[model samples]
Target chain A: MEENNENMTFENSSLAENTAVTAAAVENTENLNAAVENAPDTNAAMENSSAGSPAETDEEQKKPYRKIPKGLLWRCWFIFCFFQRTCQCFDRAYCNAFTYGIMPILRYLYKGREDEDEQIHAGLMRTRNYYLCEQSFSTVVFAIIIGMEEQKANGADISDELIMATKTSIMGPLSGLGDAIHGSTFRQIAIALTIPYCLEGSIVGALLMLIGMNITPWLTTLIGFPQGYKLGSEFVLKLLQSGKMQKAASAAGLMSMFIMGGMAAKYANITLSLTFKNDYKEIKIQDMLDNAIPGLLTIGAVFGFYGLIQKKVSTNKLILGTMAIGIALSACHAMGY
Target chain B: MSSTGITLLVAFILACYYGFYSTYPFMILMGPAGMGSIIGLIIGLIMGDPVKGIEVGALIQTMYMGVVGYGGVLPVDQFFACIIAIPLAISSGMSNESALALAAGFGALGVMIDTLWKTINTSVWTPYIDRACEKNQYRKIAKGAGLYPILTRMAISVPIITVLLFLGSTAVNWLMDNLPEWLQVGFNNMGTILPAMGFAMFVSYIGKKELIPFFIIGFYVMKFASLPIIGMAIFGAFIAWLVAKTDKSSDTEGGLA
Candidate 1:
């Protein structure tokens, strides 16, 4: 089994190496194409194009002279294109993906240095100890770090400590931002918009939910990547300090709560079928409860579970307890409780 | 299609969907709302009752609507539950409610599998990548980070899903045939109450002290007024906007509280 596993790893690594080589070739062709397009005249373009022989370009010029290459950014985005939850280890929550995604950019930045391999190794190891962030929303953090890496490689006197500290500090705010807007608010709204239609068996509703849930995350990644790289971390710090995000979060929280209330009333219907005989009327317990307060059972049940969750009772246990109680209640009702 | 072919096809779909959940495009389909509806639709179509399948799927989705697996920690695997429940409901002619109850249990099982996978990746793949980092082998690191997990995940999910689908159908059929009627009704009641837990989880998540009133107000208004949900959502957004504007004026006076 060990041998087979090793063999498979070897084959996979070879395949990945081939891809990397091809990617480098593709990037070179693109750069050359750009250089030709930008030249003032055809002769200058020919001279620029002929400045390097094909063999020399392959060996020596694979790494671009620019501080931050467009190809490297796209490569980072592609690496991030894979599910961010790909290989989560207990010790390092998301550091594996983080380090892996940034590898190409680091390689490009540190390419041709005195200790290129050593610098790459240090760069990977620096952030691999611990990382936890919202995958799509945290694209800004990745962009800022890549920007920092570029500066550091170009002799900007930036230390490894500063990079590490930036990562450690920025993740908390970004994760909170992501959790608030995307996780708590947009997700529920998407479901709210689609659930009614889906209940009617409309495929369009399902597709809408998919699109709605995804737009923000993808948009954040696409827009944040370039802006974060250009503006660096200060832009994010300014935005946070401006109190705009706070106000938005508050508004979103309010909207989420309101929508949640309506949804709970609409969907969280828990019917109590217990009824009793009275002197002059057939009294249904459900009717009495409804008369007192509309959707009272649903409201009570929601708050009850909310209290349990607040107490930090594991959701799994609550689900089981609910099922048990529900079954037991059904059995009692059958026995005319 | 033959039963074997159908089984293989469904098994393949589940495995691919579950295993490649984090991959591009598939990540969009990872949520309970998205996965449940699609899975329910597919299995329903297979059973020649597409609407019923969607109804079951929507029920599960509603029950799990508020569940956000933030930071990769699944509170319950609603998608896994749908996979188990929808097929059973469609194939064995079981009630949606009982199938939902059955799904609630399997959701826990899905979490266990996820935990086990994460643990294995921690002990095995993480160290392999660490060693590759030490050697400065980028290709090896990518393999450990990307390729290997998907393969191993497929290996783990395929057999589990296949076995569950084949055996689960029989088990549900037997339970339906032999279980007392009251217990079945109990399961249905449980399903009805399950959505309460979803809303409860959402309320707990978003319900700060100041924000709690909105939920109550939203509930009662929804109850009494009988307004469309979309219209209510717009009113909520407008009210929220007004609140923010007032709060901003207060913040200007009080200075960043």
Candidate 2:
């Protein structure tokens, strides 16, 4: 039994080494294609390369074992994509670390080899470093990217230590970017756009916001998986530095601001009911303000809240303050003052 | 069926489903069902009054808009609040503004229950998952990861929601009948003021000085033109796209220099 175990280990290492060489070759060709595709005048070359790649054809014929089955790919996608916030215990030691970051790769790697208990245990431990981070918009996107790279390296010569290290290093920056763009900007825009519709009791607005918020993460998983598997983390860094992410975020931010302004005017209902009994006519404060500057009170209320926030007032405090002021004013109005 | 009975039945089901979905499993459905607007729509359908249901839902939703559970700290329990307050309000003939106030107050209290749930989950179920992984029982690990947390959540949430629904309607009716008019008016005022707070929270999250002008533009357009909110949003999108185009061109020029 001992001799047989040794022989198995030897065979596995050699197979992995051979697979690594093939992966490197595939990576090089892909990088060249990507570079050409990015240039302005290489549209035709890009089309030709995509349509019929010599390297791809050679890889398909020679390295059949390297190809992940379609069913398995989809199953992996489903597990990692939806189970993003699983395992969020108090410690958060693996904060979606297992379900989102590691489980998909484990499933793909251990597909037909589930009997290898030792290998499974080893894989779990190796992937089980501190994986806690904020739940940003890109959380799932980064998880898919990292999981795909692990799947790509399953039979290759990459060490478990190296894979673990790569995951830890990338999560911080990716989450930061995602938080700024997806969490804060995109989500706000979705809310701003949909709130009006929701206020008017339109289900269409709710559906549109749900779809709009999900599209990016959905597309990221679909596209990031294959690309990460083929080119690894290099692709992720390049994608970030390309400036497209920033541009998209800025556009969304600008749009969100505009919609919020409109939302304030339409929804933030504040009117002065105070009227003065003069000799000739009773003067209504709200109507006069409206005639002078439409939405004056709404704008003022928004700025007032903004000023409180700038003064470092907590959200709870601000909520209570608004409520107190509103009630006080309403009571005064009720007295017909 | 009596209004209270109908409310109890619907609230119980919504609570059970919400507890399960909020955790690990069935997250896809959670998105739409989780929102106050959708919950209101569902309540409306159950009560055979979609219009009033929607109005109440929209009012309640604005209070909790842009609020999310980040880093395991649930600021408010929107699900619990909606389940308890919506049904009771609808059944008791409470005004939408009063319903909003009730829901917001319940949402704040529900935060404690949420914390307790998370604490139990961390201490009890998580260790089981760790042990299962160590034994290399992948199927057990899967169950521990997904099923256990959900069951635990439902166990706590279902009974509490059931009790709330059964008793909540009567309680609301009593309060409405006996409460002083001044306090009632205060609660109604909260319905209007709470949305302002929600908008303020959103601004604090994403506001930048450079973007303040766009907000003013949006406000005036809506106030003066009387265009629908959706129409204003489309116009905002166009302006954003134009701004992005110009910004990109300027960036390229700077790079060349």
Candidate 3:
């Protein structure tokens, strides 16, 4: 039985491969009118080629992508992209159950053989189990990859267990890498670029931020889907070992630091408004400070805040502390002391 | 509708958005609807004073730029903060500084409400999905997972926002009318100091000992050369590229050796 199934798989794959080639050929034919004219001939040829194949029934059953309508797939993408975080209740199973639970929609749409329900359930369970680990930025990528794997599996040869194992193994490294690249590195750079414009009340700045922030996740998910499908479990290791990801992140980090410094000087406002009476002259403290180092107070303020943060001061405490000092200084100023 | 009624209505809508009513995972990429700058712009448009709204929003935005909620932990509730602070600032003619100080306090309050809401959602709403899964009902499961949470979030957000907007405007007006001048000045002063605190928090998140020099360079170029932020960013990118190249070459040599 196993040998028969294997032979059937091989024949079906070869037939599908041929169809894909013909589809490509039809696409590559230049003129629009010529392509249109050739479409019926190509279809006839494809039907003739598949007609002699003994595994035609299997081929019909295996065309899961065709069975799974575009609208259903779109709905799957919508749920995977947006609502995967709905149930954060289970500790190890974070998004796993939610991701697994939604796969039935796609499976039902794929409309495999009547007896294939168990295979579908097993595939869904494996997907659910592998996605047990929690992730933020990479969750969408993981979902897309799993969806592609299910669609491609076609209920034979590629066991649910193998597919599940592939997904489970890659989750850890992908999560860590994604958090570093998307969460820490790219996000900071986006914030630095957008904040200045936001401060200026420029709609352009907000728009820029909206686009910059959304595009990364969107593009990553888009690129990750195909790469994950092609590479399977090897995708995570290839991505991490490539060293390019780290290099990009570090470069972004350095740029972010420079931008942060610029922001500090631009936004961290502190002025020494006090003027001192010196021998035969009135010296403005702020003027002297500016002469010695322009944006002197601004630099000091950033350093001071940095120092406080290094001391592990909580954000709320720092906020309250800053407020107290400001109020005290204002009171002093008001009293003319 | 009265301007206060209009403002509250807008605030309610924003609260629903922030409540993660629909496809919030995608919406989050828009950078948190509750962010001060965005909120300010929205409020500005609603109040018919986009310029002042942006100014106030910018000030508040600086305070929270370094703040991020990861692993279900939010240090402050900027959503609630902006809702209460912006309208009050606009109505009372409050300086940016005072508005910021008020936002910090209100944001902390928002954190509590957010905690309460999330607790209810996880404990109550999440189990419905598990039930649906056991029954093998795909449509039920999808609705339980997707649509149910949105409904719950709306339930939690709408009323709270309405009350805050209605009462907040009255309260801010009262404070403005009754408060002594010194206290008002104190709030104003606190605002100026708060931005430095914001920057400090930001530095802590992205600061590296090796990158300290870049920060210094950025400060000096901005102060001494009086370069705009865009110019500083360009220079920063150039330096980063040079550093990255050198680091790559050295690593390759090290690997070969």
Candidate 4:
């Protein structure tokens, strides 16, 4: 399961294309014919329809390539940011959000074309497939895809398969790292750092926590989008391969581990009530554990659950199990065990 | 301000909070530590006890530290727990244990509500998007995808949370009041123990065997020296930097060889 999920990449474009053709035929055959005629070739036309106006794509191809406008890039960033989780469906997952977010860029690329609608409709339908990843860190993927769209608009040899493959291949590894860094580690560090202050009756704790939580995601999006667009997908692949990404992830992990230890020590306060009567006096287990280590129970709880998690125990099960153990211990205490 | 006005104000805050929750900038307000604390503090101030609000908020935040919306599956809805529990804690003078129990229990319910919201988006709004896409209506697709999901969630969550706040707060207090003493103690103990799960979840995701020593070092240091969290974080950062630097040099050497 882990192996399968780690390298997961969905690519069934032929299926999508077939359905799209049928859907388009049923909806409006005349419009589809107009789109095909305006298109340079059927394949280029199909790819072209998803972006820039196919009619003008030839003219735009002749003109000098202009760098995508700063305003357009900004619009792309904000749209994705705002609508990344929009209209999530059972079928397509994040496809709706992707389509919605990239609309501006698509329109810009396909601008002033006779078959602009058909082209955009094609583009939107192409992205209408399974896509799930850490939202903020997904800026890089969106940027790269936009770059591909721009290139395709300018008559690059980019295929729909290439674009879809890029989206699928990159998103998985990125999501894995993103989930670890932004989703888990960074969030824990923020909470750990701010919780103490929060417990102390200071709004600073809450304020710092908000700042801590927001900064990584905001900065990642801010930096990732522009850099991703400039460097393109090849650069991201290079970064992934260089092992620098691993080193950086490890560094972040190390910090998170240290903080987790500190947090567990300070916060986890489960106490045991087990005792044995030896006639002289009842020997208490909690004291013995404390004598061995101050927060032994807490550490034990952490590692025990960690082991369970590594063994693929679902989080909900672990949560229930922890609650059950806590309840049982309470019952033991009630029974004077 | 009148209690009614305060209730209305809280309702508005919660409405905005949950409505734009998945939207960016608004997404920043999604975390328990961030928005949860703010909401707690706001409700606390409204109740003439900002400190209590902060404390309760912090507690919820701490418990939910490692909870992530991984693959869009939230095992527990800490945000929902926060909105419900903070108000209950402040208004009904509920015990922290009871408040936590309410948070945990209702948190499960919150997940169901979240699923329902997503389902509604899929079922109700998605068809419009598909139709819009087929007909080449860009504006309709944008509105369907971007605007409708949020507004729909607002429509669903706002009324439900607001009603829960006004009516459910006292009712939950009553329920907690009636729970057996042992169960209450069990819940209190559960609250204490739950944060361990947070840390455990934190480590399980990020932990590597090579970094195990850092965890040990961090634990023992905190046990003996009891350094503040910020100080520990700084120390950890320094160690991480050193380790990364050393590892990079070794990698280069390995490549050269």
Candidate 5:
């Protein structure tokens, strides 16, 4: 097990159970050592093998294993794809993480520490898969969480197809989320206003962003983590105290929607164009639309077709329809419409 | 558009990188937080996981992000709704009102649906995910390469953008003519009500019970301090951070007052 640990950067817990496995050392984040602090993270392998709970049950539920039958993936890929296709207006996470992060977390939580090399490998692979494919931020967390869980469980052999299916399923929704959060809102709010100040070369904006976006999120996550931990610890107690999961989902949903609605009103813009009608003649319709309507219209179009393409409308047809609209609009602009 | 304008526009577009071109179909099918495509992607990258993190991250993000139009101010866009998840929804198509509705209704649904799906998956598939928990490096590689959804979207977006580019101006007129009444009213109402809602949510979510001090701090910065928008926001965040760092017990109280 120690030999395997040396060969792999992945976190597997069989070393503790085996006892022969070398304990990978944790960077004593708490140890106040300034000199000779080059201690290796080697003991972590051994310590983790024994203290392996982090590998498992650190988070919530996950997607079904490939080996499992009659689950959501096979039974309802199409249904699930509704959110996958339309995760543009808002940033999504729980479901994607469930399939990716939750999977391994569960695996690790339920099973005893053993060789879970296959599962961890699969989870990480799926995580990277969607980053390029769709560009979501949740994908990595989903995979690691799943990997951690799977490592916790002794780890049973799961098939490639199921894991792949989970990986592929999450790619697009996650990417869209990635674009909206860091790409649009975070980037825009964090830096859009700050860039001018920073561009004029003020370190103020840069520092402001550091605190606004980076520090804010980090702080939120720090607080959130413990809240989540407390929730996890009292899972059964909370369940009994709170009654069914449905009520909680309902409250959370209403709260989430209320928040989402507020965002659309404030940030999603697509106002009319401003231009002179000469060499720069009147602004092109595209410019006109962008300036006049803001981008909310674009969001509308995506949502309008979400139900259609997600189920009945084919991908081919959707693209075809979009092109037809784009061309027609482009032509109108060209022809002075 | 001038070449310069187009260049600038392109840079902006790249920076924002709307996720619809890549993830719509699968999201619509999957019903994760439909709005969380971008966040899911970021969470994925941050976690070194990608889409899977998106699956889970979307749920988490829905709490922090959203869409509100008119006079309302939102912390983020609410693209989680189903209508917005469709291809080209937020691209060059649809009306402002429609987009707002799509984002609002569908984004809300996305959160609900994602929660629903997870609840079911948890109940049904726990044993399965449990089995395959150990494999790591390999899974990450596979997760990175996975592109079925993108391929699927590309297959669709290409035609849509191409066709729309040449379809003519009548489409725009038709779209304008067809604007719905409920939507108009909703947008108007939103303009009036949303600001209150957004600020209130910030107070509620951030405040929980600590509203007075946060509001006082926010008010001080907004009024007396009169810092720039970004500065004021940072000050608010700083205050929030200190408050956040407060012991859970302290945080729960309304305030010293």
Candidate 6:
């Protein structure tokens, strides 16, 4: 399973035109495209919308580019690229995509201002906004684009090992950081700060929510790029240098503190465990004991589910479990049990 | 009081005061059982072109959705931002599309206008939070650095979003309305669904399949049980800890933590 996943991952990560030695490279981008393109509801979008300029894609490599080793497969790349690029797609999709998506909208709104040209380096600002929205989870996107550049730099031979290694090894860690920083920490924390007002049905609340939501990720995404790229390059070089992944995971763990801490502050939830032996009785466990049980219960639920939760559990079920345990036991009166 | 400050305050008040009354988002999601979303693009283009603005709102919900507040420490201070922003946009002529987008930003912008309000808040409040975090260095940093940046962000954001919505929306509308036929179609198509797609991506990415139970628990608490999301969150955490304790002693240390 590990080997299969590794090979599959490597093949999925590789973006160069396909070659001879490792031809059946298990490209998953096509599957990913099919999953997205054939998404239950959102099919039949404009062909143009789902693809970039087809005219520009004619690089004319005779060798096929499939998981298959030998016969030419430009058609597959064309189809996926057409849909994926046109679709403006990505992985670790939510937080990164959200940041990427919003930057452009704000830029679009602001750039249209007649005096936007006068607003603090408009061209650079516009470029920043454009890149942010279009390329929020841009680690892979940029890597793929950079891989193309590497093709130019290294005489375009398509080193399967190098390409596969870079894509598989680098993508998970890069995206993990990407996911943690942008999605979990910055976006979650900021939005956590922001949403109460919007739900409250007040303009002030919405504004607070919006600013809290947008600016953090916007800033994080901007900062994340150089950090991720540098990290990726350094990680590969270090592996090359020492031939070990321990340092890489250690580095990632260190970076995770800031990200996870922020996530803890924002997304972490506690189930309140305040039940009265008798409601009429004036003595309350909370007022008397200062809610220690409830507090402990909160810590228990958050950290307990922490492992299961982080590995990508359905948020819906997590929430439901919280409520079931909350109400069921609150009625039963479990004091941080 | 100088008229400039008063004028700014009133405009801020007018723009954002309605957020307190806007229950539409809560109502929308709180209703449907399955994963449901407000059709932001339809709202944006149909209303104005605040595609980005609406996504901003969606992100706010998702980001905080996972927050588990133990004891009584409420993590976020800007819950009031969205309530303020949405209504102001609509009342001040922001279409539903644009209004939803600009609404949250406007709320924070409103808060920004009244620096006096925040200063009074932070000064009276900061010491308590500061003292609470003495045991943990991270909490200390959180109190000193983390909380205030967001507050300052809100302070500075009011006028910025206000101008963006009331004035900027017009320009955005013009561009969308006036673009060359094919280009306009392209922009409109991309503009509308792209934000929604972005939002769904966030959910799918972070909302992993295994954790569905927790999310469902949260939803259950929020929905059927009628417990406060905070209360349920705490209870959930407690049970999770007990579960962890049981899982431990006999097994390797691996749970939510």
Task: Give the whole-model CA lDDT for all candidates, comma-separated.
Answer: 0.70, 0.62, 0.61, 0.68, 0.33, 0.33
lDDT of 1 by residue, B193-221 (tens): 88888777777776466888888989888
Tens-digit lDDT track for model 4 on A195-288? 7888766887877877787777787778888877855554454444444555566677788788778767776666777787896998888888
Tens digits of per-residue lDDT for model 6 on B1-257? Answer: 22111233444543342222121111111101100012222222333434433443443343334331211122222233343332233324433333333332333343333344334334533443334333222233223322443344444545554454454434544554565554333222222222222222233335444443444444334433455434543555464445445645545654332
Q: Top lDDT: which candidate number?
A: 1
The true-versus-predicted C-alpha distance at residue B69 of model 2, in Å, is 3.7
Name the 10 consecutive residues with the lowest summed lDDT in model 2 chain A. Answer: A37-46
Question: What DockQ does each prediction reach against the true complex?
Answer: 0.46, 0.46, 0.38, 0.45, 0.07, 0.03
In TM-score terms, candidate 6 sits at 0.31
- Please rank every candidate by DockQ, starting with the best: 2, 1, 4, 3, 5, 6
Clashing pairs in 2: none
Best by the TM-score measure? 1
User: Would you estimate the TM-scores of all the predictions?
Assistant: 0.83, 0.79, 0.78, 0.81, 0.33, 0.31
- Alpha-carbon runs more than 4 Å astray in model 3: A1-71, A86-101, A104-106, A109-140, A143-153, A156-169, A272-297, A334-337, B1-11, B20-23, B32-34, B70-72, B252-257
Least accurate 10 contiguous residues by lDDT in model 1 chain A? A36-45
User: A1-337 in candidate 1: lDDT tens per residue?
Assistant: 2353344344443433343333333332332222222211222222223343465476336544346678779778767556356787678887878778889888988877789999999898876777777866567888888877775665444567667766766666677777777777776677777777777777777667667878777877788889888655544454444456656767877887887788777777777878788888787888788888868788888888888888999878987898788878888783213
DockQ of 1: 0.46
Better of 2 and 4 by DockQ: 2
Task: Please state the Cα-based DockQ of model 2 relative to the true two-chain complex.
Answer: 0.46
The DockQ value obtained for model 6 is: 0.03
Off by over 4 Å in 4: A1-67, A273-283, A334-337, B1-16, B22-50, B176-178, B241-257
TM-score of 5: 0.33
In model 6, which regions exceed 4 Å deviation?
A: A1-169, A192-282, A291-294, A300-316, A322-337, B1-257
In candidate 6, position A212 carries an lDDT of: 49
* Model 1 ranges with Cα > 4 A deviation: A1-65, A278-281, A334-337, B1-6, B22-35, B38-53, B249-257
Please list all clashing residue pairs in model 1, or write none if there are none: A83-B22
True contacts kept of each: 0.67, 0.50, 0.52, 0.67, 0.09, 0.01
